[model samples]
Target chain A: MIEVAGGRLIAELTVRRPSFTLDVSLEVAAGELVAVLGPNGSGKSTLLGALAGLLRPDTGRIELDGRVLTDTTAGVHVPAHRRRVSLLAQQALLFPHLSVAANVAFGPRCAGVGRAAANEQARGWLAEVDALELARRRPGQLSGGQAQRVALARALAGEPELLLLDEPLASLDIDVAPAMRSLLRRVLRGDRGGGDRGGNAVGARTALLVTHHLLDAVVLANRVVVLAEGRVVEDGPAREVLTRPRSPFAARIAGLNLIPGTGCAEGLRTHDGTLVSGLLDAGVSGLLDAGESDSWDGAPAVAVFAPSAVSVFRQRPDGSPRNVFAVRLAALEPHAEVVRLRVSAPPGGPDWLDGLAADISPAAVADLGIGDALGDVLWFAVKATEVLAHPSVH
Target chain B: MVGVGLPVVLWAPAVLGFALVALPVVGLVLRADLVRLPELMTSEEALTALKLSLFTAAVSTLLTALLGGPLAAVLARSRSAAVRLARPVVLLPLVLPPVVGGLALLYTLGRTGPGGRLLELWFGVTVPFTTAAVVLAQTFVSMPFLVVSLEGALRTAGERYERVAATLGAAPATVFRRVTLPLVLPGLGSGLVLAFARSLGEFGATVAFAGSLEGTTRTLPLLVYQQREVDTDGAIALSLVLVVVAVVVVAVARPRVAEGAQ
Candidate 1:
């Protein structure tokens, strides 16, 4: 069984360049897929390098399967070749000189297996990736998708216990992503042969997949860890973390409207004089409730909900829900299949209502023609189940 | 008009440069003494010099590749201070004059040199003025070209491919042999050809150390030098042979090396 018990990955590395310092700490469980989400200079690639044993952590410990790979405290550092962890970066860097079969066979040969035996094993892996037909072809001959498959087969051929995938589909075109995702799912699940003994399967291998793409995490990862400013801002089940994010970075990635406020039984009182009501928990609401509740007089909080959950109507409806607001359509922008409508409510009622963001389907938007008028009154409603309130220290 | 003219203007110098290079080769072939070519080919001295040149150049190239391939790989992969320190030292022979490099080799392997003293005390053997000394001197001078070229190729080729091989279960050494070495084959091949060509034309180092023996230490270039003092036609014939051998080597190696480089 693939198990990582208390395998802490703590790194305080300081790489001093002309500008910037990469300092990060991380802990991942076996069978968990943590996505190190960040912008370009967010130390994501550097953190992956440190984890892969390509770069040494100035002060930290990296352990896999309860074995100490790197621990500055006890003075132990394992070289990359001995780490037995597979790292597949953005580019499917297959050896151009060797044939696909030979490239796959490379690991087996290096592990001291006989040439014939390594080839036999490599052939099986090639077949698993559905690349057996191109086994004799060099990497330069394969298409982007085909080359990535060969890279996957080569990585899997070694039967490594820990798998590391760094934006494996980043270089692929949009049409190729779904197919590659499925292929990666199959490989990571250990469904194709070697019988789920090690790797990222449920009972087999453990994996750490790093990617900036949120959709990839939703499709492939079971657990999602959102990294912001080189720190774990939010970490939990992929669905919960992606849908209902706690951090602003997570909120941004999941496309949710997050506002800092105080929670109450009636609603959340935002700092900008807006009251958001219909929350689930009274204690959390009471803690953030601002209206004469002495316990939460000077407390901080955050109210968050999906833009999709906040429905916008052109006119005020008779007998509307409690969280309804009459707002002015400040701006309307098209985003893929949906249109993001930014509305501003009348000032002085509640602090946060000054700015309310809402996302509606293109069909709904077109039918309503919300883009026609800017200053027109737009009614918006949010369900209690859709509203989430948490403490906001900032 | 500017777009079309810009390319032509930029390319004219390059085209002219190639024509200038081809001029000397064409002149050499046109001016060759065809009537005496057959007589020169059958001469015992000419045959001995050709054979010795071929044998010594081949042996030296083989030795250079055998030693330089791993050294290049080490230099390419290592980041240690020792490796960094040794890289310039390994390339020293390439930049040094062939005669000076030969002197350095002599001081280390000559009759009264430290290594030579140990060899005499233990086995009573001296290295100077011998065929083996010629091979050693040629290898010493030619090895750095192979190492430098191969090392540069290895650096540009990167370590990602090797890591991919490792993930596929290939061991470190296996990755080098099967993946790393093969990827850099074009550079290595070109380096080998260059080393062989250098060794074939080697004269300063050979004369300084091996002392120009007729059947042993005398290579084609040395033979040409010796013949120039006595017979100008014989020297021209030897020079023609050297040119022909170089052309053959380039013809055979160019396409394959180009393909590998790609």
Candidate 2:
């Protein structure tokens, strides 16, 4: 863990609305981009509002770069405009009356910078974002993708100490999203040609991104924090959290199947007292890292595997696979190059396998004829070698 | 709905509505003394009434913008109970008879009224039967147009952009000036035009509160009313002029007024 004393942004607060309450404690190191992922109504926006100083937390403090932005105990609530933090929302929302250049220069001009210097800075930032040609155009003239590019330039031209991004690329077209993503990667990585001037080297900035797309986390963020029902359920490095998610929400986002159980000698025992054997996850250092023994007897554990690992059959498969369950074919969805079958536990069977998915090729699906067998009981089997069981902290 | 044609049954009432609004102006144009129009419209009394109407409408529209602009902004952004209650009250003049509005103004600012007595006793000022009273009466009746238009514009514009500006380090005042005002500029323009047109057509309030006096308070509408008894042809000519100006103002403001409605 990075030193909390050296953290660039520290937010530990609780916000209460009429029907919901958000309690989150997050610390972002300098120059780090952390992606926040959650389902809807998970307080993702509330967290962003608090960080942006748009909503005051009912309790706790928000400290950024040693400045106390909000401290309920001390009664110090710095307003949003004075906080030097910028937010880029899903909509570009560029000023309709101002030219693209003026929109970008709005922040600098508000900060009392000279008009000419602010325009120069805007042009520089626009060029960095590869949108210099759009300087004279009005916002109405720009396409969705172009507008988002200008929005990024405007957000960066402010030289914010911390930037909050609320699904900035979610509204773009599928074809345009990748280009916007690449532009964000370039500007965020701060590897552009220009030398560091005006203290906007870009690499020195901290950012918190909220998104629902897994690709955004894998491509843009160094770390991932998952919230569920207004609580942080999983927080780790992006790859680790995505690959070995302990929370069901994170697993769903990562498109992996997760089974909650207690650790045993081989794999784990479900709540129904069924023993499911699997190999210990080699990626998890120490296997049981919390000073626990390798036995892992009765410890909280989870078995994670890809949807492709499970094989479906109409009749009971006579195989050497160590794990098998009787499941009902719940639903079939067409994934790219494959047909995904959502299976639930059959009557008088362990319920832990409900909602687990199995991905089979289209040809295999045709051969199995499961498309005509919805709600019929089928056998789902996974080899012990395919399952990776590891200690679950929560 | 985008490419569909209107129902055949709907065209009758639509045309009837159009005729209802358009036939009166057509009648006035037909009744005007075309050969003597130039002479009658350019008469001394007609010219003075036109000048006074234009001047008072201009001042009152300015006053509406200066005062009504901020009031609309506050009404759009504020959620206080008092503001919520005051909203319909502020728009009362839009529905209230202009004569009643003039009476209310008279009771508040007339020589025998409390505010008028205060002004006379302390400041030695009398407001009734003056050019200032004409401007005030015009402002009082026309203010609701500007306020309702601007408030709709502000609400339709929403606070999302304002929030974006604030996060970009713009102070509250700067956000209002730079982001909010420019965003609602079209609405403000339409509101001002509407207010100006309403002020130009003001008659009842001016007659009741300012007491129509030639060269001082008698505006175009009042002059038309006055000349109807003495010179019917002159009244018809001046009435045609008022209708032409109203048409021009409404035409200029129609597009932006539609935008604010959205």
Candidate 3:
């Protein structure tokens, strides 16, 4: 098995260029796809560059399967070509002069396969991408999606142990994204799942998919690692992380309300004292209990939930969930299928109301006619299980 | 009327300037007697000079490419101190007058010169007054043209493609052979043509270093100069032949450069 086994990708890599410093530590196991999600200048690309051996990490170690790719301590450093890691940048930089077949054959040829053998292998890869018909065509003659597919084939042909994708679909037009995503999912599955021709070694390929698109991560990656200001704010299973984000950044990506708060057995309390009662999820309950002790360092924390999770009624609905709170409709904003209502919870009751934002559907707003009111107390009930506690505000 | 006249007036001088520069070549072709061409081809000295010119130019072009191609690649790829120093030194020969280049070669390879002394001491051989000296002089003058052209091509071709090649598992040498060489071929081809043409017409260096020895050091240009001292018509005929060869070389090499640019 290609086990990563607790190896730390620790880097205090400070490239101070009169603007910013990028410092982060990350770890991943073999057979896992970690999606590095962030906005621009969030050190997502910088971190990938450092990991890929393109940029030298100013300090720290990058290990893969216990093999040191870069370690400043031991003076072990491998160049980019020898790293056996494949990178698919946003550009899909296929060589312009070479034919599609020749471009795919490049890696195999470099690996010491004879020209004819390399070409044969390239044809197989092209057929896998369904682009064997375009093998003789130049990169300039292909569409953006076609070029990206060829690039993916070229990278996979090397049979790299570690694959890094930097927003591989970012440059494509929206109409082609779904098709590209489907193709990418198939490739990812083929590489990871041990049920097909691509499945040989247990964890032969570990992937890090860098993307700003949340849906792409949700669909393709096994786990999502949220990066903000050059540090990982949250990392977990994709569904869990996306639905119940632990950071404001993740909350923004997942379109949920993320507030910094503390918790007790009764519920979570915002720093401004808006008490959210009845957190019954054991995982969340344990976090609440942990926060109630003297040993509890009042470290910065986050409370997150989806907009749909918080039900808004015109008046107090009888037998509603215990975590109900009275809130004034602060602002209304129209999102895709829903109108996100900014509910202002009363201050000093529990600090859970601090910087709290919630999304309510257009149907809920129409049903209640809760429009442009400043001080109307709208009853809002959230299920206890939906209230998630994460350790940082992000 | 004045506005229309102004642009036409402004462009007239440039048009005339181009015509002035092209006049000599047009004059050469126009003045040549088509009937005398067949008789000129039959002359023994003319044929010997043409053959010797072709031979020396081919040898010179081959040597230039062999030596300059690697030198250009090194200058293109390396950031070492020696390479930094050697690049400008390579261009020094290119900028020097052909006669000055000839004098420099003469000083280094003349009978009593340092290289000549070594040759005599080691192998009991001398290169001056020989066809080999003519080839050597022509190569010395023309090699810088190939190096400079190929160097520019290499620089523009960039290291990204080579790095990609390497990552694909190509050893450094294979990347050079497959990717780097083919990309620079157009520039290399044009450089070879220019070097060949320059060698064919090389007179100053050959005369200074190899001396005016008939059938040996007498390249086409040297033969033309020698014939001019006695028979001016023979000189004109040889000049016509050189011009035709140069035109054909330019005709072939220009399209290659244009295609590469595209």
Candidate 4:
């Protein structure tokens, strides 16, 4: 039996649909803002649905703050309203017919709070979100950011055990995101609340934010769980994962190149059996802390580094770097300030090392005489200090 | 707009149909005994029928809303095949001839039908030829209007807001009361007015199922029909009252601005 943590949420859920199957397991510790990051159709919304009780999982268990919200095995299920969870979606979803004050008061009112007390609580939350002035206004009249502020206030007024935010900032204007981001940071950090903000009777005011924007995680979340195709692909401390991603999708979002392999004391041998003999940076070297006996046991690992770390050479001109691979240009496309060359893997590579992309200047392309639809064989190398090798995430 | 001047013969029938609808109302107004309208309407028969009509129609509208609300909500939210089939089936009375609807109501609640026989045998209640029968006939035909209108509004409003409310700690009943009801108020209002008007003008059903009894089941429409044969002046005078009700119905039910474009 798993011991439950107070103010903690643990879910091992498998929700089945005709077109989608979301199977994931995770734990959110007390006061932790965990961002469920994923691209579209990645089951980010589905996970929120299951947690919020809008959609029931076929077989699983979900426990929040040591209380079971759902347990299919035991046939125990709580309704959404009774679970004390609050959800804020991309749209503010403020009740259009209700005034902003009434909208925020709705949750408390439903919880059997007296109307006056509920309105006062609503006012308090609105003030916390800096939306007190909009209390009399209808949702249709409010701007995008203001509506979202009211929505946040409404969700907070519930004193929810778990707060689910699904792309809360996704629909805001570009000019509004920065301010909203900082406001959310303040609220999630418990800065404006009483001394025991997330520690009152309802346990912690824990939150799960589903977002595609990495910046939201960087600014608002303390932990990040990356989802791809409905699976928990990676989970780590927010800054840790953002700065040193170990999974391919996370690496892509972090704008780094990742090569999956098995780590040895020397370095990483990629899936193609090509020895990527790079000196382990401190971050990558952490995975190699084990002795030779443990190291050779063959747990998969990934070597991640920035595109700029790999230098292209006309001929094999690498004297210092041991990792040298011949590559042929597959295609060239424009990146922000540089042209990215998508190339086939090193010559003599196994079928597993499919391809990689490297950023180069237009001047560099011209200097190398790279042509449109170029098929010329080139060589690329990376110094040992650049690669961060870690145990594979997936 | 249709093509300008294709053929006169093709469009003549539509114009003639429009005229046919307009001429009767125009003739009624033209021949209205306006000067003695107050005196004619205050007569014993006219007053009884007017009061009975108002009472039955109001009661029928209330009953329609009370009974139809849950049915509309179910039809709006459920994806089951029976509900899908039954939604339009519930509106049969709306498209049905009122005389036919009245006959159906008569057989179901008359002395011989199983429900009617059981009611009389168990409770000593005879439903037909009574005020209750008038209310029932009006409800049988007009309830469909309320249901269909409310069902459309409920479907348009959708369950997203209700789901959000539920997650916000509001119980299902609370969500319906505070969220769903208020959101569908406009549709409910229109449905009520339409049902009221249908009940008011429910001549065929009232006469056939409830019978034409003065001060009991004979409503305004039945009074006007009786007056039309024996007293033209009284019929026109009573018609003016109906026209007033129709005007009020239009004023109350007409949608303003048509849509929430913003």
Candidate 5:
């Protein structure tokens, strides 16, 4: 039998909720799992709701694989069930009365699959999620993780062309999250744990995952789309966008330092008139596309780099090694395995420089005994080759 | 903690309030002619009233289910302020005196009111003084119980599961039949029982609108009320039976609380 291949999803829709509004236009290739990462109320769920046809967009079109799922002007709109798109909500709302297996079978049964056949298909999905052992139990008897597994199995049993996940792991315990994420990866990759790739019932699924966890994008998605205040602030390859973010939100989530500046004829200059002397053209090229040196004639650019590349010193070093600047200590926050110091920009700095984070080892923090007594200032410098400057989209 | 052991003063009224509900039924049972109960209950008038009561109440319950289901669902899901604001109007019959309810139905469907005239002009049908009028009167007084119960259940159940079911390839009808209906079945069951019990004991509206005929509208409650004029003993016996029926209905519809919200 010939498979009627699923096509890419292209949406240029504006969803206007009473409290929020999301306007985005993008396309996702078939079989690509794109992670939509944003903070709470940033229209991440709104995007998923519109795509799943749960909430109709106030305007614009949503075409999935050339099929017009929503087109306001053309007056074509498909409701949820007919749209062939499935959504896995943040909460695992399994049917309380139905057994785990029956909940899984519900989707197929709705498609007019016979009772026995639907039950058989349900068992297959249950086995895939490793919840076959708990198939006979009702939702009330299952743990949160088990119920989520059944919910996921139920969603896939319908064989949707597009699958939307709204923080599938947000409700799980922190310790149980890793297992669920990995399960999501395996199912999304269509490789059931035995390296049996073709065994997935939902073949080559197109999925959009809304998440706040960077780990979800790092592990499960090949691309990332970040939103802020109901706007698409950034979208690019997962690592590039995360590592070299143009916006502060992405930089914070990716744990990177972004220095805002403008690209001029001579070189890149910080907004506060700090001529960052060390960064080389070669290093900044990696953050931008090929025509960086020529293209960025005069544009708002930001220097992006990992916090580890910054060297902190108690006093002004004897020699200006590469680039040197003094930053006033604002506050201290503990990050994983390291101490992150929030540093205020040298006085009279631009708005973006108000909060700059630098990470140093705990031993260094204690040895320096950095506190209000030490004037709460640290002299930090970065090597020339480590400074990466990219144009800030905002 | 401060109020914990206040006194017998505080506890006496609270305890009495609890006992007050069962004491009256207990008194009726004690005064009933149990020795002659079998003979008294199976008399011609008693049997006619009991059979008519059961048949009319059953039909009324069925009507409540058919009409009240969609009304409850819409009230549960609609966002219109007008629909919400109409709750008191729908519930008026429940709170109104049964005699007032009978009078309202009588005026609206009698011989000259707009509703009555419309039906009369359209189908030459006179609503009052018929067996069908008995069912209609019973429905007017009892349907609000079903609507209120089912509406609470549907509101608590909410649209979450229905939305999930829709995304999972279930059409609108299928979602209602397969997911929505089963989720609210317990509520529906209890509501039906409440409506049935209400209809079985319906007295004021039947007497006022349908009128208490021998084999037409004289339900069990009517029989008990009339037996007091002739045989007070039989009236106590019939009253005791209605009490038993009420108890059975309550026992059958015992709340299955705390089953799934965990």
Candidate 6:
């Protein structure tokens, strides 16, 4: 049962809603914080609800640390309160009527701890979250950030075995989110708080953080699991998944232009048979060189490049870049100091390669005189050296 | 902001509406004999009615809160068709004539009624024309106020905080006691006040169900009605007393602000 030192969760479930269905299989090792990244309505919160026992999946099994929380076939189910899982939502949602100290003590009090001991434990958790000074304040009196801090203390006061964070920083001010993020990172890693509590060994508790923000995944999660269309499309270490995303949603979050195709000797060939010539990423090259039995001739692969690497021209240039395509301007958006042009394949060109973003300097947009040329055929070029082609996971 | 400006013609009807409510009280005050006001108000019948009104109103308010609170909670959360259908029935007393409400209760618990017959056969209990009947009548008529106020409060306050509490290891009952109850306290406060005011002013229901027995069942409104036949001066003084009590209840509760605050 103790496959690893920490609590390990294995969930494979299908939840059907009116307009959408979520089917996902996921695993998170004990003490590991895995960020679930997806767009809205992509089943991110549904996954959290299933894990916290607030939702009952249509059919599946969810086992955490060898204890089955839900099993449709076995007719086993655990209610949310007894599941020993806590959730910190976008809003602080602190009990407005209770003092901050009492709010934090509420979990312990509900668990049948005596008043004095619960208060003492609450203070300890509050200090761990650096919110001890707010003990006497009511939830309504605190700022958004302070309230979130107290909410975190209250969530931890119960010593939950699993902590589900549903975009805890989403409601915070932009300027205050970074500080909270660092605090979350520290506490989730077990750098603070008493480590000797039951089911909460001397390290971080198992956590599944649902977020759409890439920064949250990069900063606080050990691994990133990307969801698209209610399925796990990408799951790997945070850095690897963010850098070489196979799903369009993941690529968008990572701020990269991704072209999906099949790998060949020269480069990747799109479904329309247009060869996007590029150099294989070092990881893919290493995998091929390791002498795996399967050949890479027609395996699924993706070519990714920074949007800044794309060069746009009104007319075909003389050099003829290896990755040049006849494209049409889709939309122009202001991205910081540059104007990002969203280009797509021209009328006669392959339609699969669409919505490719090219970020160019504002001066370049003026020099090229293409600022108002929406839907006009243009040339988008990227050097083979700039593109990193890797094997697609799905 | 432009269209929100009040038109000149609108103020006339609005002022007339205000005057309609204010003029009656002014007439009552003008007709009262100020020198004998204290004497008329302190009569034995008036004092008994006032005491009975306060006691019955207090007890009925407690009973309504105990039963209506859970009813409101269930109404707010339940999606079943039965609950949806029952919602209007729960609110029927609000729109139904108070006399009709009293008749419904009497028929349901009267000596010849099914529940009354069962109570008599099992425990030999008679529920009409007693002080307890006054309380029962008050609770029946006043329940809709508390239920409506609390249901709106529960809906406005939402289940998010309760869901959060459940995840934080609070059982369903604890979540209700600690989080749900406190979140809607302002709603509960105004509901209880409205119920108390309704109970205090109860007349028609008590007349039909409890029969205006002085000291035992006759409340303030019933006493004022009884006095109006033989002692018009005492009735007017007691009517003023009822008006004062209602005003105090409203002032203490601050219904508009407290109910809308959530």
lDDT of each: 0.76, 0.88, 0.77, 0.83, 0.82, 0.87
Most accurate candidate by lDDT: 2
> Candidate 2 docking: what grade?
medium
True contacts kept of each: 0.62, 0.90, 0.42, 0.92, 0.90, 0.90
- Candidate 1 lands at a TM-score of 0.79
Model 4: which residue pairs collide? Answer: A279-A384
For every candidate, how close is chain A to the native chain A in TM-score?
A: 0.76, 0.90, 0.78, 0.85, 0.87, 0.91
Q: Name model 4 segments beyond 4 Å from true.
A: A1-6, A191-204, A259-300, A310-336, A339-356, A365-387, B1-24, B27-44, B79-82, B226-237, B256-262
- lDDT (10s digit) by residue, model 6, range A1-56: 11122478899999998867899999998888899998888899999999899989
lDDT of 3: 0.77
Give one digit per residue, the lDDT tens place, for model 4 in A1-394. Answer: 1222126799999987776788999999877789888777889999999999998899999999899999999997899998988899999889999999999999889888999999888888888788889989999999999999999889888888788999999999999989888778767655433453332122225889998888898877878998878888789888888777767777777877778788766668866577876556464455346434364336677777788888887898746755777888788888888988777755665543445667889899889888564677777787777876677655
Candidate 6 ranges with C-alpha deviation above 4 Å? A1-6, A191-202, A281-299, A318-321, A333-338, A344-351, B1-5, B255-262
Instruction: State which candidate has the highest DockQ.
Output: 2
Runs off by more than 4 Å, candidate 5 = A1-5, A191-203, A265-298, A310-332, A342-355, A370-386, B1-10, B33-38, B256-262
* Candidate 1 vs 3: which has more lDDT: 3
**RMSD to the native, candidate 2?**
3.3
Q: What C-alpha root-mean-square deviation, in Å, does candidate 5 show against the real structure?
A: 3.9
lDDT per residue, candidate 3, B65-133, as tens digits? 899899999999998998899888888877788888888888888888999999988999998889999
lDDT (tens digit, per residue) of candidate 5 on A321-369:
5767778888777879988878886665455556677788888888878
Writing each residue's lDDT as its tens digit, candidate 6 over B1-262 gives 4686878999999999999999999999999888899999999888988999999999999999999999999999998999999999999988899999889878988998888899889999989899999999999999999999899989999989988899989999999988889888888988999999999998888889889887999888988888888988899999999989988998998955454674
lDDT of 1 at A124: 84
Off by over 4 Å in 1: A1-27, A108-120, A190-204, A259-283, A286-301, A305-333, A336-338, A341-388, A392-394, B1-16, B85-89, B92-95, B104-123
Instruction: Supply DockQ values for each candidate.
Output: 0.40, 0.79, 0.30, 0.73, 0.73, 0.78
